[model samples]
Target: MDVAEAMTLLLSPQGRLDPYPAYERLRAHGPVVEAWPGLHVATGYAVIDEVLRDPRYVVSYEPLPQTTVAGWAESPAVASIARSMLRANPPDHGRMRQIVAGAFTPRRVAALREVVTAQAAALVAAMAERGRDGTTVDVLDAFAYPLPIGVICALLGVPEADRSAFRTWTADLTVVLEPEISEAELAVADRGAVALRDYFRDLVEARRRTPADDLTTALVQAHDAEVGRLDAEELLANLVVLLVAGFETTTNLLGNGLVVLLGHPAHAAALRDNPDLAGAYVEELLRIDSPVQVTSRISSVPVAPGGVPVPAGGEVLLLLGAGNRDPERFADPTRFDPTRPQNQPLSFGGGPHYCLGAALARLEARIAFPLLLRALPDLALAGEPRHRARLTLRGYATLPVTTVTRPHQATGVEPRRTVATTSAERRRIARVSAGERGTPTGAGPGTP
Candidate 1:
């Protein structure tokens, strides 16, 4: 099919399931395809990378709560996101990120690594128990959803009971992030946004009354300071963003990663034998099938990537998933090769607006995948998978898998799965023996 025909199919249900073929057709034309007037779609690795890193290209140049976009304030969902760092540009983006970056610092993430490891173990054990009777369980429901959401809620100090509600809220709130937002979708999003705002508003006050040692309290303290580091509205907007982003991407990653690894049993066995390859395996899976697929940016001035021209004020919808599998950048991009050298995929995004949760997401996958594999060695797909019918945050809606209960120790328990001899030891093998890999940032929350 031709370029426009391919683009149409991409947005169709068929293309949503597998956009790679359409991506190949688009990329063959050039690095940047002018899909329509005033709009360009980037399908190549180099061009997408350039667009992500360049400062002149930004999420939005307009001020929030004051943007000229008509009826923006009408939808609480739209208004709140506009105030978030995801929608901010330049000085404001930096300032907002600075205040929240503390929670995801190396020190904090290192600490969180331990928490995630424990959570994964618990969930895996539960999965083992559930599948012990020889019945199938939804992997997405049993493991993927709870593990990441529980960890993020722990960080944000959200109660376990309350987290169940957020699955619906986040789903509704994030529909606003889709490429085309219908009026019906906007109404649902507005309701979801209100629910979130109300919940966080109460949580903020509770933190004020009695501060806790969690991200929410830290943010509450920052907002209430005399300097007014973060205003009440900004505080609410960011908190909502964090909660939604914290789990959504990683949840998708876990689901996507498991479906891929389990489909290739040999790879799963290789990982089970060599625990140290966890990081490399996780990274490659991200490249092959990213959780967050497409991101967009607007140019403030004329720029050319790969000598393809994009005028000032022009918009480009970048297919980040396609960039990860670009043939020029990755030899045999369609195939899974964990040990590929210099493997840097635009999964999390790049430049100043790179995903803040990249490391946490990486660690979660690196830890969870092996644990699941070792816990349920015979894990295999139980039925046909159902994917979420959306382009931006692509993942499985239902990944049913059957499991075989493996033998346990004399204590009638599976011995706790031990990691490598040491943390440094694992990192050593992952980097030196497997291949050196660097985190490449691009089009995560930056995408819409």
Candidate 2:
């Protein structure tokens, strides 16, 4: 299918279940395929990597025209968020990232592992308590989606009572890939933005009155020390982004990783048997079904992504999802094999614009995955899994699962199932690193 036709499938409800074939068609066409008149898409591994690493490929350019989303036009909250590091380039992006980076530092992320483990265990126990024996549970609602969201809410000091309402706002804002979002959707997005802002305004006020040992309080202190570093609006925007990004992405990662595992029992059994393989298994899962599928960029100057020249101001969609499944780069690319030794994937983007929350996201997944598997060895899909409708972030809307009862113990252990890592795994990692994409060791327990 052509890029336009593929986009139609992509936007349609059914396409979410299987976007790979369409992506493969786009990749087969060339490195660069124009999805829309002003938009160019890079699908292959090399092309996506090149554009991501290219300094000219602007990170924060406005992805769509003004008329695309009415909420973006009407809401200053939306604009403030769009003005964040994700949409800004160079000095601004670097400055914004640095301010927040201290909190998400490697050490801080490592420290968060204990928090993640405790949270995951508590959540699983809660799920068990609320759900009866063999009762159906929506993984997305109960486990997958809630894990990271809960952690972030506590970290950001968002009150427990407001999270459900705030989640609605985040969901409405996430459907930005639409060509023309309706006035209703725009209103939803607008209201969500307002509610979040109001909530944060109150939060900022509380922090100022009585400082706490939390990220928001620290940021408020920084703002006071250095004027223009952050304002009420920017602070709220970053907070909202942190919540949305943390909640949605890691939820999908856990959900999708579980899906991949259940499909491959041997790997699941191996993980159940040998806990040491937890980190490697997570990396392979990330490679197979990346949570953040595509990241958009804009060309500032004349540039060619994989020899396809993109004019200035043109849009480029780096299909990291597709790049991860390229046959040229990975052997049996479509297979869900945990033992893939050369497991380098662009689930996290490349270069200066690489995901800062990557560390936290990985930590959440690593801790969450093992805990779930250990809690319910017989856990499997209870019903059909429905994926969320969006080409941008690939994940499930509802993942129904049933957990089998297992007696609680001090330390859980199971049979070991070992499979050698494929040669393709090492090569893929080397290739991705040679291009300066992602952190070393592919993915570890603490972070990316």
Candidate 3:
């Protein structure tokens, strides 16, 4: 396939199934290829890295809504997402990031290894129980969806009751993140945005009344302690962004990693035997099949990624999935080998706007996968797994599998094994609305 045909498939619903072939074809056209006038698609590892790291290339999602309709800023979702670190550039992004990052340090994230382990253990045990009767279980609906939401809610101090609402909120926000969406989709996203923003606002007020040692309390303190640390909008917006991003990226990682690991039983056994391999395993998994597939940036001035010139204000679609699989970056790019030393995936992105909950996401996968393997040693794919029909965020909508419950044979993965995964799993209504977007970076990274 030529670059045009490749780009076409890469953006289509069919391409979402597996864009690797098209990525290869795109890379064949050199690192940066102009797909249209004033638009480019970047496919090289080094070049995309350079663009991500360069401050000259800004996220620039502020003016995107103006193209859709008048007073687009009136929409809470647009304002909340656009205002957060997800889209902010230099000074604003830096300031907002410092506050959130400080609260979400590596030490803090590492502390959640226990939370991840405990929750994952329970989820896996439940999955085994559900499939014990020879019933095929949807891993995405059963195990993948709940683990990340539980951890994020624990960290954010959101009550257990309110956690269920996040599924709908996250789904709506994700649709909004797409480059091309319908007016109806936009309206759904707008309503979700408003709901999420209001929820956080109420949450902040509650924290003020009864502060707890959680992320929300920390943010509330930051806002109340300083004159201009975090205003109402920025605070609420960041809170909403963090929760959605935290859940979205990690959920995809768990689902995607499960399918990848189970496909290669040897690697899954390796992880079951030695959990330390999880970091490398998850890294390789992310490199081969990234959750956040594409991120874009606009040139602040005349810039060239791979000697291909991009005029000021031009947008470049950074095919992050392509970069991760670049032949120059990794030997035998298509293969999934965890042994590769010094592995770094473009999945979490880089530079100033890197994912704030990246450590949290990694920690969740690093802990969850081992427990899953140990708990479900006989787990095998029970049916044809379905991938979520979306371009930017790649993951499973339903990953079916079956296994016998080894209650007496295997020890409980967690100390307290009472939490049951019996909650109603909501089936996501898959929608595909692809059209020409006026600005390439529609909503900031679903992960960013």
Candidate 4:
């Protein structure tokens, strides 16, 4: 298949379920292939890396023009996302990044290591309890969704009780990032954005009145400082960005990582045997099946990536997933090897727009994965996992997993048999169980 046909398949629902084949077709065509007039797609590692790091190829939302979603640009959600560093360029991006960089320093992220480990262990224990009686638990809800949300909320000083609401708002609001989102999804996203902004407005005010040892408090100070590093609108928008970006990507990473680990029990056992390997294991998981599959850029000036010229203002989609699996970049690219040397995946992106929460996301996954394996050694897939129908962000909507209590850890409770007769019924049961347990039923969170 050619690039066009491959891209068409990739954008379809079935294509998303297993885009590797489509990615391979695109890569085989050329390093950089023009998918449409004035629009290019980078499938090779070298070209995608160059495009991401080159200043000439900038984020598409630099000027923050009207979105394809009619009337959405005027919506609070769009406005916030527009102002965020994720979509900004040059002065605005630099300023926004610098303002919050202090809060994500290595020291700060390291401090959260304990928090991530604790939260992961707690969530895994709860999941094990749910499945101890032989009941199937949706890992996406029982574990993956809650761990990152709880940690990010703790970092931002968001109340624990409000984490589920954040999950809901972030999930809906993320649809706005989809390139071909429907009008119905756009409306829902707008509502979520407004609700999130309002909630943050109140939270910021409270933080201003009573400062705490959290990133939000520090941001409040920055906004109110005599230097005025950030304006009120910038503060609120970036806060929303942080809250959404902070948890969403990591949540997907955990879910995707677990799916991969469960699929390869040997690797899962290796990690369980030596938790320290998690750092490398997480990197491989990221490469083999990245949570964020693709990102786009607009040329600020005439530039060429892989010798394919792109005029100023032209757009290019950087296929990170394809790049990660580029044969030229890594030996036996399709193979999942945790010990692969110098493992580098575009999962967290690159350059000035590199995900600000990369360190935190890695820390969460590195700590959470091993802890989860240790806590639930007998974990196995109980039903067909349901992947969310999202193009840009990919992860499970329902990952029903069963765990058997070891003889030594038996709680004397009989396991409940899962009685769903069909995929739809299983999904319904998972959603109902998630709701009853006060967990987020949808995909956990989303990143840019």
* Candidate 4: stretches off by over 4 Å: 65-68, 226-228, 406-448
Residue-level lDDT for 303 in candidate 4: 87
Model 3 clash pairs are none
Q: Provide TM-scores for the models.
A: 0.89, 0.87, 0.89, 0.88
- RMSD of every candidate to native, in Å, equals 6.7, 8.6, 7.9, 8.5
Q: Model 4, 410-441: lDDT tens per residue?
A: 32222232211223322332223223232222
Give per-residue lDDT, candidate 4, residue 432: 31
* Number of clashes found in candidate 1: 5
Best-to-worst ranking by lDDT: 1, 3, 4, 2
Stretches of candidate 3 exceeding 4 Å from the true structure: 61-73, 413-416, 420-447
Better of 2 and 4 by lDDT: 4
Instruction: Compose the digit string of candidate 1's lDDT tens values, residues 144-197.
Output: 888777766766767666777888898888877776666777788888999999
Error of 1 at 425 (Å): 25
Best by lDDT: 1
Please say which candidate is ahead in TM-score: 1 or 4.
1
| Candidate 2 whole-model C-alpha lDDT, 0 to 1 | 0.69
lDDT of 2 by residue, 282-366 (tens): 8888889998888877888988777777899888887888999988888999988777877878998888777777878877887
Candidate 3 lDDT over residue span 1-448, tens digit each: 7877888888787887888888888888998999887789998999999999998999993634344644456766777788777888778877677665644456545544544565677777767777777898888777778887766665567776787788887777767676556677678888888889889989999989987656677677877889776777788888898888878888898888888888888888898999888889999989989999988899989998799999998889998999999889899988889998878999999987778778778878888888788877888888888887787888888888887776435446542464432221110000000111110111122236
Q: Which stretches of candidate 2 lie over 4 Å from their true place?
A: 61-65, 68-71, 177-180, 407-448
Cα lDDT, all candidates: 0.77, 0.69, 0.76, 0.75
Q: Model 1, stretches more than 4 Å misplaced?
A: 63-73, 226-228, 406-448
Where is model 4 poorest over a 10-residue stretch in terms of lDDT? Answer: 437-446
